[model samples]
Target: MTVPALYRGLFDDAALFPPGDLPLPEAVPAHAVHRTAWYAEAVGPFLVGAGRLAELTAVLAGAPLRVALVLPDGAGQLAPALADAGALSVAGVELADPDVRAAVTALDGQLPAGVQAAVELPRGDGLPAALDVLAGTPYRAKFRTGGLAAGAFPTETELAGFLAGCAERALPYKCTAGLHHAVRHTDPATGFEHHGFLNVLLAAVAGPDEKLAAEALAERSGALLAAAAHDLTDDQVRQARERFTAFGTCSIVEPLEDLAALGLLTAPAPQEDR
Candidate 1:
């Protein structure tokens, strides 16, 4: 029942996890990991430069690890560390450079073996091109949008479209931002904002039920979670359960371990590989 824990990006601060209702031991594990990166969501703007990043990296690398780095640009940011690391930046395009193809191929030469890389695509059509550019590496991809504000949620159709696009492209991308709580609960304290996996999960399962699908998409809170999950047939329930058994978790790390007490996800296998 060792659940997959949440990796708080630079945005989540030390205070974010401390106020939870969960027990002290469970609420704040010996080490709660945070990240170091430059972004609006950055936990501490003053401490996000190169020096803080190095320190945070070192801390997370240690036992009882409580900090981490979700480098938006994995390799490009770390290229200096790994002489072979290659970094791809978006100097032209709004979200990415307009001429990424040339830049990528240019770095191909100095890109040492196992050099990591990341490309930020500015607008539409960049998805495919990005997939093509980072094709043969351990590179992972992320999609960004402008509407993660307090109460801004993309249209139901828009989210479905995005996820559909991911499915169509066979892209298993990870999401950051707007997802912080277990359900769609509001951040009682910060009033900042957070969207948990439960909503995403419900939306994914709602494809067959258009009405149900629409309701979940329009709302930005966890209200839909309880309802969307309602009315689902036994078969659908089973399917959703299977999905959860797979990679489903809106990591409230402490309580998630609680669910495993109920025989939810299969017990993780040994770490022989590790």
Candidate 2:
């Protein structure tokens, strides 16, 4: 089955930081391989940190590269950084800082045309104010799905609230971290629970209703999630993607392999025309 339109361009390569932290040279080639992989369509741009922008340019040696840049905390000038990275296209920028609002506001007039931005908001009392500010801007929202520790993962309630707020405001968002697999499950070593990308996709498609979305985020049944994914009509898939966008993952192969195992992508499923 072929990967659906809802999931195409879902996994952004984030091998440069955190858990995977592959070397820049190694990651550049790996990203090249992924762009040619059988599941290539399901992949997105390489996520590179602002600090590594110069390094990435050096490694690619004049080959054109597309990247989603993660800005450093307290960053003030985005244009100067991009100016130094040769042949690098900044597709998106992930901004998370104590002064997120100011930084985003500062970037208002300086951003390259068509370059997207995702602002990561705190998940508590400050959320609404942040959402309110972002709702009026062209920026999209960003959420952290999981981290190295269990505390990094937000509860179902928190996740649901975030989804509902975005839905209510008609804000599109992207997720990063802890979505290594296609289904929700407990990590044997860390014992930290993880959210499934498929589950999140379904929840986004299910609309912003808190109760229903929370259930989808907490769901563990791969078969049920697979069925939901299989049942998506073309337009429904597009609608879901418009809101959910794509997520960042350390390994693109993991999600693709898991989806393939679930038979949701074993062969091309019949398409339904409107």
Candidate 3:
């Protein structure tokens, strides 16, 4: 099935990450299924930590897999991680480092051609400078939208600032963690607030205005947000996606289910037996 351009390649599989923590053995096959599934176009590369490349290779046994290598330990681990990724296709690299400039410098001349890199900037006073450093470069930016703790989830204002910053620089970016559903809501079990992926998309399409973006992020009405998404024109979707890019989610099915619930995605009719 042809996925909508707005949602195509929007979800990066992070089954191995926290919460879901699907074992590498299970994740490998599950990812393979997702790749061939009808919703395949909506999925992006399988995410794995840099340290897990060897383990991932051992399990794959030469089966081709595209991966987004996560460098948690920062720039020092990038070279060795890429070296270990020889057995698999490295689709992209994500570097989480406090020193954004240094990480960008270290990343220069290191990644293989066609493999995009995103530096996870510290969401602090230095964010603008970090964005400035990444502007006009081939690299993209990454933001941590949510995590295990309450503090890990950036407030609507903060996230709006981030979207505005990226828009101003025209720097493309992807999000990680905390965006579990299609609409913004507090998790009933954990009581932790989570940013809805749909809200983020609408906010990005709102352009560089921090206030408008913040309002979109703060909106909790599913019908309203879904309506806004449906109202988006082809050019609007293209421009928004060009800046917002994709986001990482632990469960690919969760987002798919959410989108289906929002009436954004319709399941294909089952085939009749011959």
Per-candidate TM-scores read 0.46, 0.93, 0.98
- Model 1 local distance difference test score: 0.37
Query: Between prediction 1 and prediction 3, which has the larger TM-score?
Result: 3
* Best of the two (2, 3) by lDDT: 3
| Candidate topping lDDT | 3
lDDT of each: 0.37, 0.83, 0.92
| Candidate 3 colliding pairs, count | 0
Q: Kindly give the number of clashing pairs for every candidate.
A: 8, 4, 0
Question: Model 3's lDDT to the true fold?
Answer: 0.92
In candidate 2, what are the lDDT values of residues 119-221, reduced to their tens digit?
Answer: 8877778887888888868888988989988899988778878888888899999988998998989999999988899988888876779899899988999
Task: Kindly list the per-residue Cα lDDT of model 3 for residues 98-117, writing each as its tens digit.
Answer: 78777888789688889999
lDDT score at residue 12, model 2, on the 0-100 scale = 93
Candidate No. with top TM-score:
3
Worst 10 residues of 1 by lDDT: 85-94
Model 3 residue runs over 4 Å out of place are none
Cα-based lDDT at residue 200, candidate 3: 95
